[model samples]
Target chain A: MPAEHAGPDGPGTARGFVHHACLYGSDEEFLAMAVPFVHAGLAAGEPVLAATTPANIELLRAALGDDAHALDTAETAYFGRRPVERVSAFLRYHDRRARPGGRLRMIAEPVWSGRSARQTAEWKRMESGLNLLLAGLPLWMICPYDTRTVPPDVAEAACATHPARLDGERVTPCAAYRDPAHYTASVPPPDLPPPPSAALAPPTADLPAVRRFARARGAAAGLTGERLALAVLAVHEAADHLLTADGAHVTLSAWEEPGALVYDLWRPGPLGAPVPALAGYAPPGAARGGEDGLWLARRLSESLDVRSRDDGTRITLRVAGPGDAEAL
Target chain B: MAHTDGARHRGGTSGTGGTAGTVHVGDLRPGDHACALYASDEERASILRGFLLGGLDAKHKILYLAGADGPRGPGELLEQCRFTGPPEVPAGQLEVLGPAELSPRQGELDPAALLGSLRAAVDRSRSEGYRALRITGDLCTALCDGRDVSRLLRYEALLAAEFGSGEALAVCQCDTRRCDPAALDAFASAHPRSVEVDPLIRTAELVVVRTFDPPGLRIEGVVDTASHRHLRDALQSVASVRGDVRLEMSRVEFLDLAGLRLLMTFARARAARHCTVELAGVPPHLLHVITLIGWDRTPGLRLGAAHAC
Candidate 1:
């Protein structure tokens, strides 16, 4: 038996095999991490039950390819407001096909805030249903948000009666609750494309070509240069891996993992000759003293950025800033 | 037969009762001819004129008219009600003067008055050669200003049995909404025929199901355990004799304990024959109730969900 993740015991402190699952991290990461367990289980002649929303089910099915024994609970979506019955029905369907050595794995992606009070009752019912399903079966539960958003009763019940091994942290999980730094460090950053190869002559003032390139490749490809540039800076500041295409660039200052072009396209530079200051001042990650300097760089993707008095601090990357950001 | 001496010397104009001759009370049945009661002399005179000139039945020649304590011997009563011929062909001629009974005491309810009214109705039924008589509020009012259900049913049974079995059906109306709670309670209490619909489900034998936007039964909160037992007994009784008689549960909201017990009994009774008892319009709450009690698992009791309209 494993000392489960909770209380003072940290997530990394596990003696037994720890299964760490992430939701919507990336198609590649998900396939690399989650798919092997499913295939291995199925190949072993043990039934593997996987539940995702209707849209995600298709993606999963596409990924699963030939091993599609999955049945649709109405296109992989439960029909009504009652999550318990829907999950119960899904489990029932799975039970019919379950082999002797099979185990149940259920993943639910709630559209609402998992931490909100409004969904407490519904969550409790869902927990109860999950517990019911857990009877006579080994179940693994994954919810990709903070559990603190759930009502205290629901959290307590989940902690006490629920037999599931829960994943995902909306607020924070108990195992990582005491250590804020390790918890914060665990949040993986988004993958960005590498800079274009072979530096060419600076653009002319017209810059229409650069604009078109940015518009076509960067903006249209869902990466505006501004945000991408901001993210690149943030990634450099954090000293974490920046996965991209155009080959892996091991800068002295930053950690960069290449081959992200599969998902991102490069936007050409703006049509203007570089100014002296701009050309002279290199990025912190690509500067003279690189890796160690980047290592010394603070994590830019944090909740607080402002410094008191003379204290200098960096702000973490958030889609919204300050007053506009949604409450966690 | 025992009151012959008392009856003969009680009133004036006794020997000369009528020109058509007096009729003995013994000839009355549930369905006879017409028996009427007049509140005033003017009404009596007009009624007499209408009957005599308007063609009356010779059999229904006996008349009882009481106006301001005036003379009303059988002879004058006969003149007041001269027979012409039979009323129009196939006309329902049986009538009863249920409200004509007089008593010296005011506001005192007399059960005998109702009996007498029923007796008059029976006499009128006999005169008309009809075996069926309709008794409405007039007969009910004559029975001391309130419904006398037992006496009414007893009279009905007497009239029906004499003429032929199942010849009479008394249509008793009980509007719970308009009726006083005490009156309704009293009526419901005394009358075995009165049914109070199960509120959870709007099914009942004799209880009136009210129509609302969301239709359901408004039950009288009190549970009639005896009635339930009676219903069960009735169901069980029929189960053995007629296996084909379907126990209809159309208006029932929810089965009470007794109803459930009876249903189980019936199911067991018919289990040998493999006959099924069907239940319809069972509400979800009621179904839950039954399920909680484990009654739903009983064999031979098949119930279908109500169709949503």
Candidate 2:
């Protein structure tokens, strides 16, 4: 099968690699794309960095097999018995590795939900410290589960420093390609509750309710073992592409609507109407077909750079290109 | 938890209703309380017999003393009369109670605990049919916050309806060969009542030991070792009459000196005008000091009995 649209340069070629090498679609889809890059960097004697969650870390480790290097805060805390230091330390370690097969990987997990005050304070300090310390690093912040756990302040700070592509929560470094592994599903396990404090005193009657709430929250966070396993499987899918003979490239189908506009005061979407949807797309089952897809994508990109009519909501577009020493 | 008797002072959140009035040890009148500040053995003994024996009944009362250990000097007389150290007694027995042990920090007594103790003490005293309650310690004792003596005394006043007001006494020895002008000044300031004995001269009912002589003030022996009952009788006699006669006390000396000067000062100032002045139970030493100093000719003194040798 031709797989819907063949995309701009087709698949399986590394020509526009770095320019559009970002992975998008879903958390699973991004994992599918990231795994191979991780392996390729390890094999090519370059290091990889990932900032993700504990549940996602478990999935990544399982899919990467024993040869892949893995580090999540919880596992590191449990095994190393020392607090995880600087996020840059992982990259520094990879750079200094004596062996050729060693590659450094790092993930910053945001798991504070219903935690103690002391724990919350400690987590905030650690996150703030790490973000401030590694502000300039090229490490990919893989917020695979969700970004809500990371406080809004941290998200804004990180996004301000780096180029961020947010697609209904599937954020990445830039425009990304959707690999086949983007869509995977899993079944959840039965919920449980927290334990009693003093066993000798009395049996805890409300343990079941507490467990139920915990499970509900954990499920919403995409932290169940089953969901994590599915994400791990997606990583394998990404690894398959990275391990292919040449760079197993993928292409993103043009969004049938315009690129998502983050609420800037712009009007006239080509035919001149406020972008019908923020992602700037025609509703599904609309009359527009093949040309509509390309038109929408281009319009979205162009609208992103358009200057708005109002002052507060004004958005100006700038055009810059390769080999141009000067920028617009 | 402190209640105020004066309309000028606002009552505490948990204050009980109370009013202001002069408290007589035997009157047991409503809203009448005593403020007992004992600085000397005689004062302590006087307070012990007066309050404990239903002497101050017109007022709700409290006892204030210094040093909670086995009473020192005048305190020993009180110790003999069932006054307990802070440790032996329960908190209920004392009103506005604070001890050196209750607070670890200096000048910071717990107001809550102290107030609670006061209320409890008042309730206990009422149930026991006692006219007044007593809290033994200096106003300068450490309380909840670092409050000054004056403030703490006011606080005690506000909390308890009647508070005993007294002073700590300073002792001096004087004669012609070695006259202490400061000591004489202190004695003059005391303005002790002049009493002429055949040989001994009593001053403010206290025993006097003269170490020096002032030009006009006679020196004599005084009697300060009078029993609690005898002291009580002396105070009652003066208190029974309505007059402005003042009692001088600077020339007096005692084994316990706390509040002695303050008592004399209070008695003189509180007395009404145009009343008969009678000096009673002057310690023999104070009488001797008075004669030696030649103060018998001084005004405002009446001659009284000398102790039988």
Candidate 3:
């Protein structure tokens, strides 16, 4: 196992929002960096929450023995669920365990190699967005990446999202880390093929017909159960954004990718100003002021990519199906 | 078999029968499955008395399922309702039983068995030459006994499907004070018609008023993180049972993002079912806020004519 290294303040004295990335080439290397980080928190009496793969959790449990019982663990299966929900769950857990005037420690690996392309994109967005969401909170989070398992591009993206990286027992600042707001703002829309020519015409007076068209296409493409339901909601919320505006027109198309249901909505307008990172995390019932539809669409779908051009704004929403992992 | 309140009696009976028809306690028709939500013992007894008396006057066989609490027993309830005759128990016009008597097995609530028993009772009432079988019961005891609520809802749905338009009537009573809000909401949705004799009024924080007339829900008070779960459960219950829902939000003082999200989810689900959701009586400022969010243009959702903003 890796040994715990002393920060500037000495060993086990880190505070505030400390973001770290653990780059390891093997399970032993990952556990080496992870176990000591968790043990340091336990020694300092900070609440520790671990949200890693089930295999890693068992490894830590075996290493910690009875002490592992005290650590808060998240369901590993949840990483593949809606990114917003996972964020909400983490916030809730943090709120519950965080002591007044005390800091909380968390180890979260929200993205893995097997995740669908859409899931990976959403997880990356969530990683960047968390910088704003957890600002001013007394929390420290370390996201681990398995160099042997995670793709090179993903590992590179992690370096850009986290302020620091941990290699074995050595910790150093990541020169590549970009401010979350700037990084999120610069994320280009997903690259997808053009919609089939048979796409539904622009929605006008008949909004219900448009929703029905999307639903029929989604269902026929083998999107069933929760995936289908999520696709329908995402399409409706996005279409609603355009359908409600005067003279606004929207063209809808849906098709099945290898492991996802994709809907493309095109309207003849520029995507409005950049949506704030915190908008997605706003509590329900709080006055949204504006961006209500966009906020809702983002939260409902697995991934939402908006490409704005002088000619039009194209909104692409991807919902991961049961076969999402299989396609990877 | 004689009552002096001719006008009220006539009004009650006129609304009975048919899936689309409205039926209150005083106007219940056979084969109707009604849910009555009460906030107090007095309200519970009043609704029960009206329902039972209406059945007796119509010459139907009456069955009362009482909990241990009260109006203590059926005799007390009859006295409260001002029945002029000696106890009609020996005369066989009415029967009072405990909730367990209807259970197919001890300590368990089986929907299929319960339905079978109800069907048997209906048949027995017809063979005994009664006009119809009218049953009323307090579900608090069963729920307290750990009866599965989903099973109970399935039973209610089964009852509605089997006898909703026929000559037998069942009124399941739930005391709001004893039941959890989520359970109460579920019970309300399971039945075809629900009546709240005692309106649910809480300290100004939040109050969800479920109305049967026109079949809609009125939300008054703040819809924030503190109360969004309650709002979601309440709206979901109504949405699960009915296609067209009228939401009266004019009285709503404040609605946060969470509330708006719940509303949007509800509207989307209803739209998928091809149902219309009408938002009525929205204050102008709130209307402005809703329009700002572009929710007014959501599919299957309509802003009522009363919305000025």
Best model per lDDT: 3
Off by over 4 Å in 2: A1-328, B1-24, B27-30, B37-39, B55-77, B80-107, B123-147, B160-309
Residue B41 error, candidate 2, Å: 2.6
- Residues A1-328, model 1: lDDT tens digits: 3334322222322222122333334555445433554555555454454555555556666777777564222333343233423443444545566555445444444433333342344344344334333334444444332243433444444433233333322213333221222221222123232236422223222122222222233233243323332223333322122211122222211111231111121212321121110010111211122222122112112211111112111112222222222321
How would the candidate models be sorted by TM-score, starting from the highest? 3, 1, 2
lDDT (C-alpha) at residue B229 in model 1 = 45
- Judged by TM-score, which candidate is best? 3
User: Which sections of candidate 3 miss by over 4 Å?
Assistant: A1-16, A26-32, A75-82, A116-118, A168-170, A185-189, A205-210, A216-230, A241-249, A256-260, A275-296, A320-328, B1-20, B23-309
Q: Taking the tens digit of each residue's C-alpha lDDT, what string does model 1 give over B58-175?
A: 3333223232332344344444434344234233442322123433345433445544555566576656665444332223222222543554345434433443433322323233
Positional deviation of residue B295's Cα in model 2 after best superposition, in angstroms: 14
On DockQ, the leading prediction is 3
**lDDT by residue (tens digit), candidate 3, B1-309:** 011111122212212122223344665777677777766555565576668767778899887765554444556668755545533443677776655666635756566876787788888889999988898777544653343477768777787887765778888887667776667667776766764332233333566656553456776655644567888778865776555888877556545444766787787778999998878876554454456345677778878855432
Q: What is the lDDT of residue B135 in candidate 3?
A: 82
Residue-by-residue lDDT tens digits, candidate 2, A211-301: 2332233233333332222222222222121122132222111111121111111121232221211111211111223222212222222
Model 3 TM-score is 0.51
Error of 1 at B38 (Å): 41
